[model samples]
Target: MWGIEAGSVAQDTASGQYAGLAPSIDSWFLSQSASTASVSKMTAAREAGAVPMVAWSPEGNLTEIKNGQKDAQIISMAKSLAAYGHPFYFRPFAEFNTNWETYSLGRSGNTPQALYGAWRRVFRIFRQYTGSKSLFVWTVGYSGSISPLKTAWPGSDYVNYVGIDAYDWCTSSSWCPGDQYRYKTMLGALRQFDGGRPAILAETATGLQTADKGKWLGAALRTAQADGIRALVWFDEIVPNSNQPDWRLASPSSAQASIQAALKQPNVASPKYRDITTLESYAVSASWAKAIR
Candidate 1:
């Protein structure tokens, strides 16, 4: 299915455009630190007929989560989701293989074992409190090292979907602008570790480094479809940092035209989304929930 991480932009603008092209739209929620769950965001997405996907970052110590110091806070968030009574995609501590996140192995005093313990603790807590209403997604940054990626896995039992966050930023003098890569080339290696689980392009965007974003978008969609990727969620936002190029897709641009054309393809449009109820079945299944215990 097609979706977007609206970032700071209004969800209506991002979702409305996609809804015009596809039968269903997916909305993303990114929570930084230990903020309370935003039930209203989920409600707004559902009201607009979009499925909500949330990425929750603790932004604090990973050891606290593993040691149960954050149980109350985490459980409170899970309860709010359960009360909503609908299935939603839940990803915690995303990009853990990179140095940017607090829970990542590159952080001081953190290790692969520490990340695994923290993830399992959070996963088990949510599974206990929310039942099958939450679909756990394990996401890693596309730029992370392959060795760290293998070591940081929380195991297949705790994850429902394997996701990768990648972006195509043509070229910039500040960073390696010429280091751009195609969709399949960036994702091919990671997909091998998916363990037969469905995969998602959880977060992605292409910068205007190239004059024609449309061609870039078309190529990306074609690659994703050919690789059997289950979904792609565009990160539709402008990075506030001055050094970063705006990643938002603008109207009257070739990139926008390419998106419109690519989304019209049968393989990309009108997704047969899995019912949220399927989460409940997975939650209670021996194969899926065994590790949670």
Candidate 2:
């Protein structure tokens, strides 16, 4: 299955353009604060025939969450998602290995033990309200401090999947100029840490370099299949980094043909409700509107 992290943009702007090339996308990845709007966005994804994979970042004091002070918000989110009544992926404080997140190790007195405890606390809260509807994903970034990746594991009981966010930032520096980083090369460490759980390419994109972006897309999908990566999500936005590559595929570019070809493979699953009629019936039901609200 293929998904997307649409960042801060409108859902249609991201999903619509990709759907134009691929028949469908299996999931829509969304990042959210502790906002009710997240629930609305999840509902919208279902209406568009795509499942939602939400990365919920509290973005506040990690000590508070670790100490159970934020149970109310976590409970509320779990309840809303449970009421939504469909299987969806939920990742809390994703990229715990990276200093960019407030919940990461070595940030504000946080350690691996603290991260583990905090994750278990959040996981327990979600279990109370969501039951099986919420699938917990433990996600990390590939290009960050490495030790936290091992220490932050919240045990197999709490996690249903392991995901890694990686990108091909080909540039003219000594690091990666025109580098065709194979999927396995970037994700090898994370994959080993997965411990037999399903792996997902939670977020990824390629920059324009000397390599053929189209061919690269095809190769990525092929490697993902060969490597037992169960899911993938493309990061479809152009947030600038030190390297000057526009990552957005919303417009026609050199990568379009390869993207289309890759997505059309028989192994790739398109986004469609498991049972659309049932979902529609539930939506019109009185309980549906009240639950989502």
Candidate 3:
């Protein structure tokens, strides 16, 4: 009754957790493998309307899944995966701006050019594979150290949705005078890239008690509505994982209630994710996104 990530999917299959969990994975992620047996299982799971989410470790050489590492490798693998007959979410190198261990920009001297090359090739391949809404997600760190858009921005044409990953980015340095600080910056950046496209908070954590999560979330909703951002993906740390600790850990019920309330507000738009097809038309021209200043 849950979406299985790569780490847990292995054991789940071995222990026959699939028997208990298969139904829950409906419309969510399920681990797929290079093996036909696993693929068949995944297919069966998906045929039931469950989304057998597959991870494309393109940046990781289709084996390692690095952050900003591969270009030709990603394109090549994308083709192979498409031929395989099962592609879900189509999500690849997610956290580029943030300094995550799995994948990051600063690694192997990842430059803007390298990122662009990889992005363009991936976009082209994905377009060729699925010509409609297939869902390709490009996620960013909510509190990116590299501002000045150019350093942080990637090809918008390849990205159907804009996702921001923010973890306790409310430190004195990261935050400004008050709520106005993060709100203005996030809204402005998202609006520029959005261009009428759907956007999501992607991953955010109000884990920290000091930060006024309620106020921050409320103001963000109001500002995004005014600016017209699409949706908000709350990063609640249900338990310890790769995303917790470093981000906001919501404690007070008020913080939880406030953020929940704001997101539920009907007037505000919901975050719209990208499918496999129609990425090109929805995405911003590489040239235009690079113009970020």
TM-scores, one per candidate: 0.82, 0.80, 0.54
Q: What is the per-residue lDDT of model 3 for residues 1-293, given as tens digits with 9 covering 90 to 100?
A: 11223223343232122112221121222222221124454555444433343434353421233244454555555555465454444455565655652345666665545555555566676677654334565656556544534544455556666655554444342444343324346545656654544554444434445436556656655655465444343433344555444332234543545545544444432111222222122222211111111
Residue by residue across 1-293, what tens digits does model 1's lDDT show? 66776652255445446434422335556565554677776766665555677888555577777788888888778787777777778888888877877777767677777788888888998899887768888887888766766566778888888777888765432554433244454466665665777677788777664445655666676677667667677776766757766776663253555656656555543223323333234322312211110
TM-score of 2: 0.80
lDDT of 2 by residue, 210-256 (tens): 23555556677777767777666777766656544666654336456
Candidate 2 residue pairs that clash? none
Ranking by lDDT: 1, 2, 3
How big is the positional error of residue 246 in model 2, measured in Å on the Cα after superposition? Answer: 1.5
Decide which is better by TM-score, 2 or 3.
2
Error of 1 at 12 (Å): 4.5
Off by over 4 Å in 1: 8-15, 18-25, 171-188, 191-193, 209-211, 251-254, 269-293
- Answer with 1 or 2, whichever has the higher TM-score: 1
**RMSD (Å) per prediction:** 6.2, 6.9, 9.7
